[model samples]
Target chain A: MAIDLNGAIAAIGAGVAIAGGAMGTGMAQSGIGSAGIGLIAEKPNQIGIALLFLVLPETLVIFGFVIAILVMLAGGLI
Target chain B: MLRTERMQKVRLLCLKKDRRAVVHELHRLGAIDLRRSGLQLSDGSVGDEVQQISDMLIRVGGAIDVLRAYTDVKRRSQPTPVKHMALGTLLERLGSYSQIGETYQISAALKELDDQAEILGAAARVANALAGIDIDMASLRSDVLSFKAFEMSADQVERLKSTIGERGISAEVLASRMNGKEFGVLVAYDKKASIDDVIKGIAPRELDITMKELHGKPKEAAARIARELAENAKRRKELQARLRNLAAENLDKLLALREMLEIELEKGNASSEFKVTESAMVIEGWVPRKRTEELESRLALATSGRFEMEYIEAGEDELAPTLVNRPSFLKPFDYLMEFLSLPRSDEIDPTWIFIISFPIFYGLMISDVGYGLASLLLSWYITRITDPDGLMYNTAKIWELGAMSAVVFGVITNEYFGFQVTQLIGFQGIDWTKSITSILAITVLFGIVQVGLGIIFGIVNARRERENKLVVSRSASLVTLVSGTLAIAGGFFGLMPAGPSIDMAVLAVAALLVTIIFGGREATEVTNLITHPLSYSRIMGFGMASIIIASLIDKAFTPNWAAGPLLFIGFLIIFIALHFLNMILSIFEGIVQAVRLNFVEFFTKFYKGGGIKFRPFGYRRVYTVDADASDA
Candidate 1:
């Protein structure tokens, strides 16, 4: 259960990476989700198009996840 | 399976006398999408008829709404059976129903009763609130004195009395416990005293008994109001019964009449799209090639062999509407296609490809038997409750298929709610902890294959469209993707020998040059050629996250059998709740991510979906049948 300073820093970095990505995704989706509701209210059949745009920003978080995994691997943690 | 139904542009010429009949037959056949011919007819009769039918529709629609409101009939899950009747018979039924003055009279009487009942109901409520007060209701509204009644807490009533006393307002306060735990206070003061301000300060709700109808003591007033209410109720019941009986007798006929009027209105509207001359009418539209023979036969019957018909090939610049017909099982996938966009008539339909790949992506993302079974049950329940024709039901069917795929993958992986069932059976299964790299490779390879297929499809589409530059660039992009993937595998993963890596790297560079040269401004997408396939690794990432979260929940909340009963039961509940939450997350992420991969990553390569949907001119009749079908 004891971790070296470098290992701790690496874990913290991974956490920060994911946290930053998640917050970015949340901020982007907050605007999209609200606008998408308005769009769907007026034209319900555009729900699929709305969802496509809504999830488009998810790639940012996926990249962060990749980075987190890479950090863990480099840190010999997983 | 990969293309929309073939269509032929059709033009028809029929005698003006037979125009309406031919149009009706065409609508009944439901084969052609009627298009507007450029020629305009100056005839104002069709416009007048459209207005007349519209007015009739409004009256019939109102009657239907009124009748439906009075009845407690549940909507039928199956469509109402069509009653075969000649057009003339339909018109006769409609004419008879329209002339029934009793239904309108009943509606008017019911409205009058409702108005009366509302007034009486309000008086009854106020009378009930004023019960047990002995003062004359008229004196409470006297011009020389002011009376205010309030329902408030006992403490608030005491405070109000003291507040009035402090203000030096000469008022008589009567307080009594009303229903429940609240007190009713009646305050009387001189009209000149400005006591309203003092009462407003206390913030107690004041009861209004200002209606002129109440004159005697509260009890007597209540008695009079009750009598009126009973009479009002009696009249309402009579009107409602009459309306219900009217509905019972004429509801079906009224519905049929409405259908006939709506159809007549549609024919009138469609006539505006026709090109009319002094003695002839011309109509142009697209018809599915397979249905042309049927259309010709039906048109011949309708025009009595006096119509001329011709079919022509669609022009290259023209965009024909798309129509794709699939088997019942594949119908749900059609919903997915429509969700994103429909394929252009000339482009290959990617629905069959998505049908095969989507479930696999979903299964890999939600690879656990317990969650899979839960998803299946959940989707089954949703499918049962939702309308079969709605998007939600189709989505549930797709979910059901994905859940089955999940179960298949779960069996292969030996995962059951993150527990390795293979361990108990002493059998070896793919272990995520030890085989992360291999799993990542497989997902990436799957991504490459799909992306490669997309590029190949792009080339095929471009070649068919005779866009030579597009074909060359797409071909180069495909080569670049393959060589770049091999180079990365060799250089980073040590999957291929170093010599092949050098050759692959050189080939990748050459392909990129060709892509840049031929792709014009779209060459900027060269970066996506590498990043897109790598994006599929999120599948493995999300699946691992689900597994790790489940494992953590198990470790943190799994009950100790040695613990006492209460503590053990508490932990067990938390354990199940956490697992349920995890399953929901897994299912949601599985669907959104799987669909995202196909729609955004794979589809962006080839799909340029702005195709119009084919909507033939016809109403699916529910109450009336076609004349020819009726004869049959």
Candidate 2:
């Protein structure tokens, strides 16, 4: 197969978008977890707080899904 | 955040006195359990004749209760201690029996009865021995009591005879007993060693004492004989019939006897109530303040003005109460205890950390929008059953989160189920396969930023923890963040080849080294500080490896569009199986990586985890379906 630079570059853009999305998630994971620990450490009382943070990283993935739509739009896959 | 406040939170909600009651109440209600408690037969002390007689009577009752389990005709019969010399024949004595179940309760009644029987049997033999010698048997019998024990050996009898003869006094010997077990001595005597030595001098190896039921040739032979009897049609049928009839006739009577015997269980036992369903007596049970009114109402209805009711506030004794007939779904997560944790400024709970990273990693590794949707649906259903309280729902919600991530990532790569959609967008000469290179770039890119964030958090936490040294010490993280950022920016901006910005970034490296080598001296060695951040690079290496491995497995497993039915089916199975295996592996690895990040990357910077959590006194029911104790 001939190297399709245009298609490949498009793929790169899509991949970068995903990376950015994943970065948000990865960041949120550590962020929420550490924040939960910090909260638990101080008050040692907030199971609810820790639990909320525990679930917070999921928003990254949820929002990251927008990139897939962007990919479809940008690539004209639709 | 619920976690960041509440330092010096009063976890010890109950006082010592309250704790005692809590533990006591839990036991009374069969809520909490200790592994084992040492309870001796007679409090491990000698007693007067009356006390002794009562103890023996209780023992006999216990034994008869055990025998009643195996046989009928025990309705009116309470066990009576065997009158030592009254029954002169060992053959005529009664023995203890037990119910046969796979996990049988060791019948205390049977054991006590067996001990008393043995004592009386020995006494009878002693009486016979005295009679054989024609001594003042009556006087000797009255002054000297008899103890039921295993059969003594002939050599042991001879030794006794010799010892008595040498003393110029002729004494009567009553009983010679066989052990109920094997490899145990004939008697567990006060002087086991000396007696063993004497027996060794007198008896042959074959005749040395042994434990009953432990191991013995004769018993083994009997067991074999019994098995043979069972195999034979005639004997087997007869035995089976007898046992069936025995069960039919004795079942109800034995149960009734058990209840009667159970009543006796709490007669004098401390902190025990025998009247759960009996006479309406005011029974005080300590409960948490939250449940106090509820319990009062229940008691009021249960007693129906027949007895008084009192609800005591559990002070320090606030153990989780045992709810009777608890459901399987309601099993305690009380192990997730609160502690008087460290003075919190703003750190993170380990559990929350896990909850965030794990699902995202899972989604990234899977990188299949279709698969993520499947997982999200299945996990959502499981959450309803596992965490009805929404605890597990939120945890499992991450799958949906991951699905969303997968869809985004899949689109970004211009791929869906390994199909490139970017070419459809009219992008000229677009090659989707080149997206694989982007996956690596993103992996490293994300890793750099995450590592950077870890350092910032470390600095902030260190400042809050009042560690001035840590603030300066974690400056290396800031340096790396800047250097990595500059490297990516420079590369993107066409400033230089794909190397980190060394020209201006050298200043950051100098500061990084200063913090690492000097600032971290008290916390860690220069070598460790210099090398620790290097460890963060593993996120890139490991994360990339996971995605690549998954992608390869997916490709290898996917069926050929043109293949025959059987071949396609086989490939389909292989595909599903391989991906499933990869998923399971990733679940484990992702969690481990998340922990690694939390403990090594984040915690080492600013976390102090080991403060005893506060535990407030409360009542928690395991299940509503099974607290009645009727089935058990």
Candidate 3:
């Protein structure tokens, strides 16, 4: 049997959090890819800015973590 | 008839005066040669000019020296920028101090320093060549007469040792040679340093060998050779270090002067040729239209007015040489996507699609009016500040655009950030949980469609590549899509018992047949195709997994027991923290699902990536120009 209605709510929240991360990672990885091609076109020095853009998507994960902690505390799970 | 003219732009060959000064200066510098490879200079003066060849030679020579030094440093020490800097500095200092016409003197010094290490290495090698054998002491006492340095390899030497050790001969045996032969044989020796093995290693050498009596001098000669080798090796290390220090002190200066001279040449009336076709060299440059008469006069001095000059107008296309502005946000996206290598060649530009789908999908996935508003505002602001081409200035551009598409579904599903607010507005509340389940079901449906699309594309691309894997894999996928999709649709639509549909089951069986019989293009198995689509379930798994967890946490963690002020503050903190986590999780999950949607479902079937990207030989200027001017 389901633990409670709250259990399903938590389940959905977790899924949304994961999906959010996936979206960001895709954008980031592609950024990294294009940057690689650009650097190769120009040479290694072009890599600095490209690397920064590639890591920028990681902001999503930080946001996801925030949501996760909120969810946990709100439900008294933490 | 269509009126179109194919006219090559008219370029002045030279300024009316001798345009040689700047061209000559730039050739000496490494700027155009090394830094700007695709540099387009009007092919008027740079090439076929005096002193350019010597300049190129010097630059290439310096590069070789630097590369050699880099490898040498890497072998013994960590390769750091500081070491490179030291070498560069030394080159510069030596170059400036050198006497006129004595460039080779510095080069000669560098070469000499480098040679010392090479000589030491060669000397050690020759010594090793001289003392090539592993012989025991007892043999030295016997074979003292005639000894010659002979080359013996590891394997042959091993066999000789084994032969000698097994015999167990004593020192009493004779060491003798034939009168006219080069090599001598040592008679049986007692077991010393595994003697039997030594004899076995000494294979028959056809240097006209003969038997003779014991000798004493050769062993002494071998030991002397070994000593010489050790001393040479020690000297080699000392010499190498000295050369390294010398190079580190002077190499930089020489390189800098050379690079500076090269750039100076480009500033003059020199032209550079870039490769375009097999025979035609492409040279792009500008001359004042009014100055054409003077430029033509200069050209007449070189070619005696034999070469013709022409002019082509650069119309209002916005792709002007003077402009440099690019849409920052859109530009950043391409870099990001390419970094991930998400888009392959066969399909449409995903960037255009993403500009449409991402925001909408994000809003739907989030389902909070407040959060959507925040994203819309943030995206719009960033889009404006980051982009500012004037095309995307409104907040609705990001959220309302994608949101408009996603909200219909969001509203029907009653998902307003994981809760229904209909009752708060004095309306009967719809069962949001049920609608959410249905929405989730729809997400799965889309995933299947996307994956099915992949299989189709995979088959088409495979045929083009002439690879057999495409045929079977794609056929199997078709079968899976047909049977599985029919089953899912039938069940979801309530066409059957909500358990299994006969039509779908039959289609599934047919799909299995096709997969087993056709998809095994690799010849290893048939079950892979049926299972491959299952991998796509990861999309749903990741997406659903995040939402479910966030919702579950919200349910599990809502604060209830604390007092007024503390309780409110605590609740706020928890809500903020959890939302942060949700943001993180959602970002990762969205990327994963997006990738799954593309890579597995779409790309697996449709993507034929790995095409050479089209890069134009346009806008190769070094100076930054106004962004708006880039177009005109």
Top candidate (lDDT): 1
Best by DockQ: 1
Per-prediction TM-score to the true structure, in the order listed: 0.88, 0.40, 0.41
Model 3 vs. true fold: TM: 0.41
Candidate 1 lDDT, B541-571, residue by residue in tens = 8888888888788778888979988999999
Can you tell me the DockQ of model 1? 0.60
Worst 10 residues of 3 chain B by lDDT: B206-215
Model 2 stretches with alpha carbons more than 4 Å out: A1-78, B2-354, B373-445, B475-480, B491-504, B517-563, B623-632
For model 2, what is the alpha-carbon lDDT of residue B91?
A: 14
Q: Write the per-residue lDDT of candidate 2 for residues B1-632, one digit (tens) a residue.
A: 21432221111112222322333333334312221112221121122422433443464455444444555443344332222121112112212323332102334333444564454443433332222232232222232332112234565566755754554442333432333321212222222122434445545233211223112233343344344433444543454454555455545444443333332222223223212222221133333334444444443443342333333333452332222222332222212212212322235433344345545555565454445555667666867667544445544554455556655554444434443445585532222234433443454455455555556766776776687777777766566456645754575555665444565367556766667664645434433333344343334434444455556866677788688889989999887777666555554444345434444544455455443332222223221222233343
Model 1 chain B poorest 10 in a row by lDDT: B75-84
DockQ of 3: 0.04
Worst 10 residues of 2 chain B by lDDT: B35-44
Which structure is stronger by lDDT: 2 or 3? Answer: 3
In model 3, the Cα lDDT at residue A67 comes to 56
